[model samples]
Target: MGVMNELIDPPGIGTLTRILTESAPMVEWKQTAATASLLGDLNLRARTDLVADALVADISTGPVPGYTTASASFRAALAAPKFTGWVLWPVSEAAVTLALASDAAEDFNDCLALLAELTPRLTGEFAVRRLLARDMDRALAAILTWTAHPDEHVRRLASEGTRPYLPWAVRVPALVRRPEATLPILTALYRDPSEYVRRSVANHLNDLARHAPDAVVDTARHWLAAADRNTGWVVRHGLRTLIKKGHPGALALFGFPPASVAVSGPRLDQEILTVPGELTFAFEISNTGTRDVRLAVDYLIHYRKANGSQSAKVFKISTLTLAPGESRSISKRHAFRQMTTRVHHPGLHALELQINGAAHGRTEFVLEMA
Candidate 1:
């Protein structure tokens, strides 16, 4: 709704300075004073790095102070009741930074524990990437235990922090290459009582689907076998990407089989669209099969890129079963606005129907920049 960077916009510098000073009385934090008023121009990740590096630099003067002082300072701050919120983003990062430097096994464990402790305030999700990058197995071995933690936040971290493609978090290349690595964690929590934890598990599965759809579908199958009331939502969300792409396994998992249907007129109300406006479009699907058939109807917007080529994005529309000779009409009002995620470039565009993973009824349009 607003500038995306403001979403992670931390507390004011004065607020951070005061909190740092008061939360960890054991540390001097000298370098904290000089951080420029330069934070506004930076996005969330850079802003976090700026503050964290300063905290690392200011930890302690002792020769081996990096890991020692920072961990101590973070622990001391944990003891203070007020050490929480978006400001903890940088604090967690600082702890991870210092821990990455140490060869001690305990430091790695402490770092993981520190992240879990810090997550309740503000996610240590971003910071934990350092540990994951350093040694994924070691980090995951420890993180697996978090699924059983009493706090749902910690359980969510166990899934979310290990996501193969966690947004705004650093990529764990190993996780991408080996999507199955985190499946055990997901397995443990898919039926979790807390919706917050299950939601993270769903997103984690969705991330895995980007790289390994088979593994994700299989995992979803396992989850289905042992489902709770919330498992349906989790499995559906986890399979979203695969469903959009028309992966048969995902489609079948959702009861949307290969549909024998005919599509007609994804006709646009206007063949030309002005920016910051709305386009109304409608389409119809009819059963072409003799027996009942289910359909997962989707739509694609082939957006024009800057170089005149097009990239398509799929959006879900609806799902239904059509009996022999039955027809259903669908209509939608799609808004075109300049959001941070996508830009509207004036050019030739197209819309199409995707029924059960098959493309049909393509209609062309033009986007005129307003």
Candidate 2:
């Protein structure tokens, strides 16, 4: 079975339906159960949609008066021990959908309250997007408040909800256009005590870096001025993409000086290989400058795609300090394994060495199917 099916299978949905009935006698369990029974034939997204639609229909038809009342009962139902972990994800999705529907008509305060209460159990990050689209300032206000909330999950929501490129969630164009709006929220949680919150803060800043590198670099400089270990971790993670790109500011932040190195002796173990095989290579790095320098060593493989085009993937090798006239030998083995996400085609592949973002020492190998 696929991952989504495993997460919310038939048995789990049945249990969730039963819990709803027990928590709110006013709900028409018969209809909800019937809807859930048909979910087995649907894909993961479809199943989520069907379950949510059924619940909304049942709540609208049953004795529950309005969106707020129905949301309250659903939140209470989810409190049962059985609805823990990923199983509650679908329920949260459904509840958030309902809240968004109500929020569209200007009945949002109750929905926001429901999300704050429900997010600790399951994320309301997806639902919060509707608010952002309808009214950005209002959403920003709510998100800023969440950054200070006692619950780590809610504080995380503040960052996760505002991410310009949040996976599986709709993009916020305003934030994409003006990423600075997020600076307030990020600054508020810069030194958040919870690792969970700090990680989300890093991811949010990373998204911003893609659009506004200078802004992110400036923020990194400010955050690094008096950073604790945890806050420093966030800055490092936030600067990963910039570091990979060899941005001078990002490299300087990590103490990697200008590139003053020599690369030589590039060798590939095999000139030809097959799928499910390994490609090993080695090279040497020598410091050619007058002073010691920190080197961030990385390599890139220009993979030939099935379309006869090439794409590059960067891999980190190691980081070390090299004094003048010092040299070090480094080696790496890359396995060309078949993966569900990628299809391999017979073609020529090239590898290159990178030191602090400067490229050198190129070599090539051929790949074929067995």
RMSD vs true structure, all candidates = 4.4, 3.9
TM-score of each: 0.79, 0.79
Each candidate: what lDDT?
Answer: 0.84, 0.80
Residue pairs with backbone atoms closer than 3 Å in model 2 (clashes): none
Q: Write the per-residue lDDT of candidate 2 for residues 1-370, one digit (tens) a residue.
A: 4775656667877887888888888777565677656866677667766666777777778775457657767767766877554545556655656666673454465566667777887787876776787678877887788877999999998899889998878777898999899998998898999988899899999999998998998999998886877877899899889888777788888888677888885799999999999999989999999999999888888889989998988888889998999999998999998898767778898998878877888888899888
lDDT of 2: 0.80
Candidate 1 residues 73-100, lDDT tens each? 6776676566776668888888888888
